[model samples]
Target chain A: MAKIFIIDDDEQLLRMVSLMLERGGHSTRLISNPVEGLQAVKEDKPDLLVLDVMMPGMSGHDIARDIRANKGLENLPILILTARAQEIDRETALKSGANDYLSKPVTSQELIEKVDELLSQPNQKMMPDRGVIIGMFGLRGGVGQTTLAVNLASALRRISQQEVCLVDFSPSGGQVALHLRLQLRHSWLDLPPLADLDWLALKGNLTLHPSGLRLLAAPQVPQLATEPSPEMAAKVIDLLQKQSAFMVIDVPRLFGPAFMAMMERVDIALHVLTPDVISVQTAVQLNRLLEKSNLKFKQKSYILNQVQVDSQIPQATVEKGLNARVASKINFDPNQARALSQGVPLTLTSAKSPLATMMNRMAEVINNRVAKRSGD
Target chain B: MGATHFGRNQLIHMDMFTDAYRVTGRVLVGAGGIHAELANPSSSFLELKDAYISRIHQPGEIVTHYKVAAFSKDNINFIVLQDRREGIPVGTQHGRSIYTRGRALSVFLTVPSFEISGEIMHDGKVAPREILVQSVGRYQLVFSAKALASLYPQISYSGDLILVQKDRIGIFCLDG
Candidate 1:
C-alpha cells in the first residue's frame, strides 16, 4: 500500500478523506495544519499528497508551490482538493504545481481514482550531480540495442528535464544519429586531439535535436572516422560529464580496447538481447567475461528487447542461460516500426501506448538503479 | 464481563464542536458507544487523544494540539460521528430495537456559529419540541447530518451522526 500524506484545515474533511483512502488499502498521514504538513512531507516522503485549498496560515496552493520548488520533492504527486469548484480556482491550483485538482465533497470513487492514477505515474527525479553514464551493447545487430539507447536517452531528457546525450560510439556507419533523424553534419570525427581540443571544439561535434537531446554521432563512412584512443575517449567523457546529466552510449558489436574502456566508464552497462538461443549464449559469455576478466566491470545486466513477436525462445530459458535476471523487458512494440521510420523514440511519443509506457518505465528503473548504486 | 465487553478499543476520528471552538482528534471508544461515554452523567469531561484545537471561525488552521485532552461536556454543542450507531447508546443499538418502527423525520437546528440539518428517528408523534423535551439524555442523536457554517455555507460537513446537546440548540425545526 502507498503511504499518502493529506493536509487540510477541515478536520471533518481530513478525516473523511483519510478514511476513504484507507479504505482503498492505503496508509495515510493526516495533518490539519499546512505548515506542519509541509514539514511532515519533507521529513517523511509519501507516494502521494492530498491537499486542501483554504487552510489558515498556509494555503494548499502555497504548499504545492513550495513542494515544487524543493529539490527532491519537485516530482512528488500532489492532488489539490478545494471547496472552490470554479474553473479559475482549478487553473490556479494546477498553476500552483498540483498534479491534479478536485473540488469539495469528492465521492469515494473519484478520490480513490485520482489517487490511484497519480500513484501509477512515474514521478521522475533529478539525476545525481556527478550524473550516470549508461552504455548499451549487443554482440550482434537487430537486437534493439540502438533502440534502447535512443529511447533511454529521450526518456531521461524528457522526464528529468536534464541534459542527456546519446553517443553513437560505433566506429563506423552507426544508426544512432539516423534513429533521432539528425543529419550526418558532424560526428566525433570533428574533434581534434585531446590537448588541442577545447570545450567549443568538442561541443561542435555533438548534434542537437529539437527535443533538446544531444548526440555524438558516428561518421557515416567508417574510412573517414578514426576511433579515438582510450586516453582521448576518457578526455571526451570527462568533458561530456561536465555538461550532460546522463550520457547513453550505443556501443558497437565488438569488444575492442576502446570499447572496453567505454564499458569501464559506464555507471550501468546494458546488454540488449532478443529472445533467441544465439542472443542468450552471447549474453552469457559477455556477462561472465565482464565479471571474470581484468575489465571486471559490474555490468552483468541484460535487457530483453523482444524484437520478435513470437517464434522466440522462452524468457525463462534466456535467463537460465545468462545466469542472471533480465533487468527489464522491452516488449515487442508494433509501434517500433513507425518510431524507427520517423526517427522518434517510442518514449518520445505523447500517446500512452503499451510500448511507450514500457520504455518510460524501463528508463525509470535504470535511472533508479544507478541512483541506488551511486548512494552505495 | 468488562474484559469481554469493554476491553477492545475503537480508534475513530471525530470532531467535537463547542460554542466557541472546534476540537478534533482520535478518540478511543469502548463497547459502550461514544454517545454513551459522553452522555454518562457520572463523567464530567470527555477524553480526546491527539487533540487539535481551532477557533470556530478559522476552522482550517490549528491553534494548538495536545497529546491528550479533556473537554467539559457542558461546553460542546455537538460531536460529529462517523458511525451512526456510535451516536446511539450501547444497550439500545441495532438488534435490540425498542421501537417497532420509528418514523424518520427531517430536522434542522442551530448551534452558536453553525446550522445543522439531519433526520431524527422517534416512535412518538412527529413533534419537534417533544424530541428534546421528552428526551431523558442531554445529547440528542441526529443521523446523516450536515453542519454548514452560518456565514459561509460553502464550508459544510456531512457526518453519519451529529450528537447534539439539547441545551446548546438556539433554534429547532422539524419538517412534518
Candidate 2:
C-alpha cells in the first residue's frame, strides 16, 4: 500500500479524500495545517502528499516551497488539491513544486488514478542513466533563453521519453525557477559538498519534475555562485547520463568558469538569437567566443527566436548579416511571455501557440542531430 | 494520523509587506500631518521609485504592500487605495495572468495565480500617459503607457503610479 500524506485546512475535504484513498487500499495521513504537513513529509517521508492550495495559516503552496527547500524531502511527489479551479492556479501549483494539480471536488476515480500514476512511477534511482548534453545560449536578455530551454527540454522528453536535465546557468539573472514558477528552496548551490565528483553526489543535487525532467537551477543568491570547473561540469554531465538520457544546459550569457567549462563538453551548442541587430551582433560575438575556445564550431547551430513577429530587422537581412543558415526559428507570442512570467511553459500553458509547435519541431531536429552524432 | 491546529499562531507569518506595507485606503489629506499618522507603510504606492510609468491595466495577482521611500509636501504619494492581488482572465478557457514589474525587467512576484478580470479600476489615471491595459485577466490587467511621459517633480510624489480598481485603488511601479 502506498503511504500518502494529505495536507489541508479543510477538515471535511481532507476527511473525504483520506477516506477515499483508504478505501482505494492505500495508507493515508491527513494534516490540516501547513507546518504539520511539512513536518509529516520530513519526519514521516510518505510516498506522496496531497496538498491543499488555500490554507488559513501557511498555504499548501508555501509548504510546498519549504519542502522543495528541504533537500532531504525535496523529491516527495506532491499532488495539489485546490478549490481555485483556474488555469493560473494549476500553473501556480505546478511551478510551486506540485507534481500533480487537481482542483477541489475532484472525482474519486481521478484522484485514485493520479495517486496511482504518481506512485507507480519507478523511483529516481531505477531509471536508466544515459543522455546527450546540449547547451542553449542567448546573447541578449528577453531573447527567450529560459523559454527556449524549458520548451526544448520538454519537447525532447515528449518525443523520446528519455531522461533530460535542464540546467539554469544564469545565477544572477536566473529565471528558470521563476519561469517554471518553481518554488525551490535550494538550488545547485545547495548541493551537498562533494569530496570528489561521484554520480550519487551529483544526482543528489538534481530536482526532478513529474514530467520526467530534472533541473539544476542556478543559485538564487549572487554571492553563492558555484562555477564548476570545465572538468567538473563535463564529469557531472558524463555521470548524470547514468540517471538521465539528455542533459540540456541553459548556459548564462555571462562569461565565467561555468559557461566556459560547459561549452567545452556540450555535444551540441544551440545559439539563440533574435532578428534584431543587437541580438545578431551579440550572437556573432558569442559565436566567435565559442570558436576561440577551440570547441568544434561545425556542431553549432543558430536559432532565430521571435521570428514570427514583425521585427525591426528582416529575416533575410539577419541571415545575410550573420552569413549563417538558421537551424530553427521559433514564433513570437506575447501570450508565451505572459505565461512564462506567470510561471508556466508554452507547452503547459497554451499548446495552440505557434511557439509550442516550433519547439516541438526543433526538438525533432535535435533528436536527429543526437542520433547522427551517436552514430558518428 | 489526522492533523489538527491549536489556533495559537494560526495567523502568524502572513506579513508580506512588513518591509513595505500594503495600503488600500483613499488619498488622505492632512495639513502637514506627521509622517506616522499620514503615511500608511502598508500603502502600495509607497514602493514607487525609479520605475517605468504605464497606463495599461492587465489583471493578475499583485503584492499589496508598497514600501514608502519619501512623501511629497502634501503628505501624499498617491491618490487611491490599492489591492495587492489581481486576477486577469486567460483565453476563453479559465485562466489569468499574475505579474508586477519592478525597475528594469525585474518582476516582483511571490506566487502566480490564474483568474480573470483582476482588481477592477473604477476610474483613475495612470502615469506615463501611454500606460493602458491591453489584455485583461481575472485579477490582472495588461496596460500600455508608452505614450505617457515620466512624472516631473510635484507634490505627493509618494507613489510612482496610480490605478483605480473597483472600490479599491492601486499605486504601482512598472519596469520596462
Candidate 3:
C-alpha cells in the first residue's frame, strides 16, 4: 500500500476521492487548500500526490511546479485532476510537472487505475540504485580504447548478474557491433527523434549480443553532420541508465558534442593512453582541456595501454609527460589482434589471459567505487 | 444484507439493489474526461444527452463524441451526424424564421452485431463466461450488454443500461 495525498478545493469531492482510494487499499490524506497541501507535502512527503487543477488561490499547476522545484519532493508522482477538461489544460498540467491529468467527475474506477499507473512508475528517488556509466576516452586513436571498453563491459557483466549496456559514441563509426559480431538491421539512426525516444524506442534500437550485453552500435555509415547532439546524447545516456545496471560507453577521440555529453555524465572516465610520445602528449592536452572545460568526473583513472611489446617510451616517461600517475598498465598481448580478428573480445574468449585478468580487476575496482558512491 | 449505503448518502434496500457494474479500466470520455464507476447496469439504453456529453466533448475535436455510442450483445450502433447548426442567421423571407441554431443535430445510426468471449469473477472465483456486451465508446469495458446478461441474467433490465463496475475482475478481454 502507498501513501496518497489528495489536494482539491471541493470538500465533497475530496471526501469521495479519499473514500474511493481508501477502499482501493491506499492510505490517503485530504487537503482542500493548495497552500496547506504544499506545506503538508513538504512535511509528510507522500509517495503520490493527486492534485486539482483549479483552486481558490493557488492553482494545481503552480503547486505542481513548486513541488517539482523543491529538492526534497522532486520525485513525488503528481496526478492532476481538473474540471477544465481542455486539451490546453491537460498539456499545461503536464508542462507544469504533472505525471498525468484527468478531468473532474472521474469515476472511482478510473481514479484508482490512474493512481496505480502513476505509483507503478519507477521513482526518481531510487535513481541512485540505477546503473553507473563508465566512459572510455582516448585523445588519439589506436591506443586500444575500444579493446579496453569491450573487455571492461564484458567483465562487469560477468561480475554482476545485472544488465550491462555498451554504447558506441564514435563519430567515425563504432566498432562495438563488429567486435561483438552482432548482426544488426538497426542502429541509433533508426531511433525516433530524441524528444520522442522512450524506453521502448531505446530497447528497440539496441542489438543484443551473445555475451548478454546490449549494444547501441554506432551508425554503420558514419554521418558526422547528422550525429546526435549533446542534449540527445545525454537523453540516450539517461534512458540507458534506467534499463542497465552498468553502462560502458566507447567514446570517440574528438571532443565534440556527443563525446563531451558522455563525458559530462560518466561516473568514471578511463583515459586510455599508450606508452608513446604522441599519445602521452595528447593525453596531457586532453587533461588540460578537461580542466579548462570543467567537465568533471567523479573519478578519473589513467590507464596505460602498452600496445607494443618493445616500447620506445617507458611508463615513467609517459607519466612524467602527462603529469598523472598511471593507475593501470595493460601489457601488450599478441593474441589481442587475433581476438579482434575473430570478432570476439579477448576477455570472453581468453578469460584466463593476463590482459583479461587485469581488465577484470579494473572492472572490480570501478564496481566498488560505484557501490561506495551509491551507498553514500 | 438489508440496506446498503453507497457514495456518501445514497441508500437502497437489498431487495431493490441490482447487480453492480464495475469499471475495469480507465475509459477516456470526450477529450480529457474519464468515466469510471461501479453502479447498477442501466435498465434501458444509455443516452448521450447535450448536458452530460458536453462536459467531456469539445468543438473541433478529432474524435467524435458519439461514435459507436451504444453497444449491445446483438449489435453496435454507429452514430452518424445528419445535420449540425453552423451558427449562422438569415433574414426571414416571409415571416417564417430562417436561422441556424448551434449544438443541435440529428444522426443516422446502424447497429452491427458482434460476438464477445471473456471471463469474469463470481464469488471470489474466476470462470470462463461469454456474454454479449454493447460496444459503448463511453466506458472502458465495452461489453455493456453481455456483462449484464452474463452477470445478472435473472434481473429484468430497465431504463438506461447501467454499466456494472467490478473491483477484482480476473480477465475481461473483448473479442468480437
lDDT of 3 by residue, A51-80 (tens): 986565676777998998899786688989
DockQ of each: 0.02, 0.02, 0.02
TM-score of chain B of 1: 0.86
lDDT of each: 0.76, 0.56, 0.62
Model 2 lDDT per residue over B14-62, tens place: 1011112222211222221112122334443433321111121210122
lDDT of 1 by residue, A1-376 (tens): 6899999977988899999999976899999988999999999998899998766677787899899888788778899997544344565676777777887668997788667656644334423457678778878778988888888889988876778888887777888877888887888877887789877898888888988998988887656545777787777777888888789888877766777778778766677899998888787777676557577544446778888778388766887887665655656778888988998888889347555776676566555434443543
Model 3 residue A101 CA deviation (Å) reads 55
Task: Name the lDDT of candidate 3.
Answer: 0.62
Q: Which ten residues in a row have the lowest lDDT in candidate 2 chain A?
A: A120-129
Candidate 3's iRMSD: 15.0
Tens digits of per-residue lDDT for model 2 on A329-358? 565776775876677677655767878876
The positional error of residue A201 in candidate 3, measured at the CA in angstroms, is 0.5
**Distance (Å) between predicted and true CA of B1, model 1?**
38
lDDT-better candidate, 2 vs 3: 3
Cα-based TM-score, every candidate: 0.49, 0.43, 0.44
Winning model by TM-score: 1
Over B118-175, each residue of candidate 1 has an lDDT whose tens digit, in order, gives 9877778777777787654788778888888797676666677888898889999999
